[model samples]
Target: MVGLYAALELAPEDEIRLLNIPLKRQTEDIACELQVVKLRDNPKYIALSYTWGSPTSLNNEEGAEDISSKPSRLILCKAKSNSPAEPQPLWYRIMVTENLYTFLLKARDDESHALDFYWIDTICINQKDSEERTRQVNMMAAIYQSADIVHAWLGEEDKDTGMTFQLIRALASCCTGNERHKRIEGLKDITPKALGTRELTAKLGACADISNWKSMAMLFHRRYFTRAWTIQEITLAKKMLALCGSHTIDWEDIVKVSEFLTVTSWTRWISEVTGSHQANHAVPNILDANKTSGNILYSLIRSRRFMSGDPRDKVYALLGVAGDSVRGKSRLTPVYGKRSVAETYTLAAIQILEDSDDLLLLSCAEGDSFHTLPSLPSWVPDWSCSRALGLGVTGYRRYSAAATIPRTLEINESDRCLTVKGFRLDDIVSVGENKQDILSGKPFPNWLLIINAMPPIYYTGQSRFEVFWRTLITDTAGTPPCHPAPHSYRPAYVSWITSKLSACVNETAQQTGDSTFINALGALAATEIPGSPLSSNRPLSSHDNERPGDSKNSIDLDEYETTFSHARHLRLFLTSRRYLGVGSESLLEHDSIWIIPGSRVPLILREVNPSAFRVVGGAYVHGFMKGEALESNPLFRDITII
Candidate 1:
């Protein structure tokens, strides 16, 4: 016990603890032994990655409840004595989560003839000693990267999991290495104009059947995908296997499919022919090809969906995989007990703000949402909260409201307030129904009404119809946004407008002035027609709206619906300054928008008092996306955000 504790403090570059699980015997409790070996000696070992606590979703797989909610059980770890005088080995009963114990049992059985050593964080690190825990934590990137094999405990298989994995393999066929080469050959001949047929609707509908569709959602809904710490573990591993009971899935297979899904839609929509699986430009943000502020901020933005018990772990776990620029600028260490989560997050925020000349982190600060940490300031992103969407959508950073301008800020650490210089961009004069409300089959005429009541789009010389379409898609298309979204998307947008209007036609029973706007929108939706010249004279007929597949534009409408997934989480707004854009769903009627210098996108802010404001999150204002509002005599004021 004495030697084991001292060895941790003296841990060197090559030193690591690997549990040696003896061959399993039936009807016996799991037991293990430890060996502190030098990696330079090339001791082959497997690393296990898992969550020690309950799922944030609280919807654990049935019968795997013990894996998440079971109380910790002791595992006997017999270690070699420090001296020969003490001939017998000393025993330590280290507490292990049931999930860890389950892995030990399975690994012992599976590897009884295959291997002997395993590396797991819980028992390996002395959780009681903060310094030892932090030291080992800092070495996680190395440990995971060095492992012979990384096994992710995704929890025991549910009834649907086997089919889910089978479905994944099937859908992933087009993205397989062989198909990648074949797709590229076909891609050269398939122009963006011809890719509309690339919807792969019939093919997608086949593999993405109703059963498989629900299974796919359930697969992702599993707790394993949502852990923040696992981000680095998954990214750095040379090879990983996601295990659910006896079922095994190659990590590469999952990624190949995910990358395919993330790319194919927007890649085909754009001029780029990136059908190859090796194209890193279309890779996940954490595994991005380049090491820059883009890697750090972009991954952080995407991580809002992942969970961590310690808020600080949200930042610390990701740092292991962040670009060198981020790790170098923010020399952050995982000090578990010294600071409050708010203080730690603020420190991380300050470093991130200073790292990127622009306020890239600003895009992550979401609107008022559910947060466990009450002390967290409004300006700082509560990474634990899913929050809502923002301008940080993939490739959205290209919208440079303060293009190339370095960020400027003065943080009053005492109160956790951030003050910055910027001009008042606009004030929200009218805000339509939120995404949830509109998508819930509620009154969409309110949206039509709000737009009808809006003042002219005098700033950009764009029409109401033009701004309406552009704002919905944040005025950009593609995964990596392509500016002035292709004209091909117009018919799709009009098609979407018609479909939503048709669903709520029954709302006419409780008709108000909004009914007239609904009638007018049907006409407005006809502004664009597929395979025909753009004009508003052709009104959309009832047949086109009701029976979707019967219309020629149905394919384009489905394309718009699929691509418009991000906008479904946002609200469309018209400002007092005559600006139009999509903003946070938490937006209100009078929220103000500001263009802070060094910030890439416009910020939606709500005033709390004369001196302070609550951040309502970032926005995608049309016309002003490219620093359009910066006048020669631009007025800059130090606005304080809580």
Candidate 2:
């Protein structure tokens, strides 16, 4: 950690670094200095957002300088000069990181770009001073928002950067309604010899060469998109420019291309033409910047993949770009060393729940059996960890359970408990271990082993297993109607399940033939037989007796196979009452399924002590998820969760 003991206090407003860009000199090297100035002064400046690469490797020596040996003070010069007759040089001592020093040198060298000042975090704030660092971090939203332009420096360019930016600009131009034909003409003019010799040009449909798409993908894959701080830097800037070495592209053009690629079937098209599934992986992060409203929880969840040196920055970095409602409710002021990581995250969860007045935040909690912070309640999500457990894949689905009863959920911080008014739905009685192969990205061959491992009750009749499987994949409530039915009356769950499964199977079969389809179906059927372990090669009666030419038999086989395939994404769990549901993979046997009043889904809670429990994860209990528990013998109790 960077530490500073000396304090240099400024006026009570947002103070930012004002870079004194050195005048052109005949010398090979020119030194640039930075000073602090209030943002209210309306300085014409550009804000830089870049990642601080990995730490410099230390030299091997008997006596090497360490953190303590480094200089404790930085010389800061004022941007403005005093009268020439009585010139008085003023300097203040502060600390600066090596990364900031390199950035300053680069900015000074780029004399073509005119700017009176610049605001960069490392140099602007006295990082050693906790109070100043906290104040500046809290005002980051305003600092970036007030800047004339935000310059996104993507580090030194590589050989392909020029071609990448050219393709990006050309694709962005194609998005303009009137410039489509013009852009097409421009692309046709520079068709690479490699593309011109092949049929790729014709296949691209007036867009840039297919090979260029690979270059564009490489550009987006830069570390710039993966940093948590850049999200707000690009989103909040009034006018932004992306700089890569000598090349530059407008931020608006990048946003336009992102929007265009997302709306068009760009990813599918790229895969079809170039046979590359990874072509558009970075497009989602670019689109995230355009999202201005809705739940901030989704943004926070999505940003977990991003890296930050300081763990607290995972939440602090996003407060600026988060919506007004979330920003107001969270009210997360950055307090550097005073609060522990557990306290920061715990407080964030409490505020979100209190503000939304719902249990949606609980849905984001994944089970942490070995809790990183023992002081933190189980219900609070450990944002520092990368494991995504609760709600599993279904958490991302856009559907909420019907609201039939009023819920009042409150947190008792002093008691370290969460008190909610709701009835216990069921207790988890059995849970199957998540397949290591599937989690490791390998195909799981035995779906039946998982099903057969469940209690016999799940395999009886139409099977509650089918209900659980149907709920996991399709958003039944969000499905469009088939005709005469009113908007409010959605299709029955069973009918919707059959239709969706048949559609998926038919589509897959159409793409790959009957041989692959039958093989997949046989594998699924082999799992349903009694006493058949996952490794058993014995073919079941269902697979052996199937008539390939029978349409009814094919549909039934497809439905079963499709359901099994979807269920592979979820872990099967049984309630103490023997009720079946799909839950987080980390769920354990004693965890309780709860239907809090405002929650759209049931949540899993694990007991910590006698009366207090912590959240294990969330669940998709088939029968009770849609407020059914509230309708049947509705009883409210003070449920204490810690």
**Decoy 2 TM-score against native:** 0.70
Check candidate 2 and list the clashing pairs. Answer: 4-128, 74-94, 427-576, 448-527
Best by lDDT: 1
| lDDT: worst 10-residue window of model 1 | 270-279
**Residues 1-642 of candidate 2: C-alpha lDDT, one tens digit per residue:** 232112234555666656665754575443345555777777778888876651222222212334523434343444344357655444444455444444555666776644557777766666667787877887888988888988887666668778777767765665534332232332332323334444545544434455567666556555565566776677777888888766889876676555444323343343344443332343343434435544556557655545565667878887877756655443477767878878888888777777675677776666664256777777776666533234423233333443555557777877657877666777877665442333233332233334444453343233333434443433232112111111221123233333433454565466666646434543443343322232255442432232223223112222232223322335666666666677666687787887777667777777666556777766776555555565567676777887
Residue-wise lDDT of candidate 1 within 1-642, one digit each (tens)?
445556444464568788788777564766677768777787788888777764323332211234454448767777644577866765666777766677677776775424567788877777667877777777787788889888888776678778788866765555524433232222222223432344543445454445554555455555676667777887778788888777888876676555544444433232123221122213333342222333655667766656666667877887767736554443366778888777777788877766656676766676775335788887777776643246536436567887666667887878888888877777998877766566455867667765666543435665466677667777666434467776556666766776676666557536653556466664454443322233444454432232224444324654565455544557878887667788777788888898887777888889988657888778988888887777555777777888
Candidate 1 clashing pairs, residues 3+ apart or interchain: 357-407
Kindly report which residue stretches of model 1 are placed more than 4 angstroms away from their true locations once superposed. Answer: 1-14, 40-42, 53-70, 80-86, 111-114, 176-213, 262-294, 323-331, 370-372, 392-395, 455-459, 508-555, 608-612, 631-633
Please provide TM-scores, in order, for all candidate models, with all chains considered together: 0.81, 0.70
Candidate with maximal TM-score: 1
Computed on alpha carbons, the lDDT of every model, listed in order, comes to 0.64, 0.55
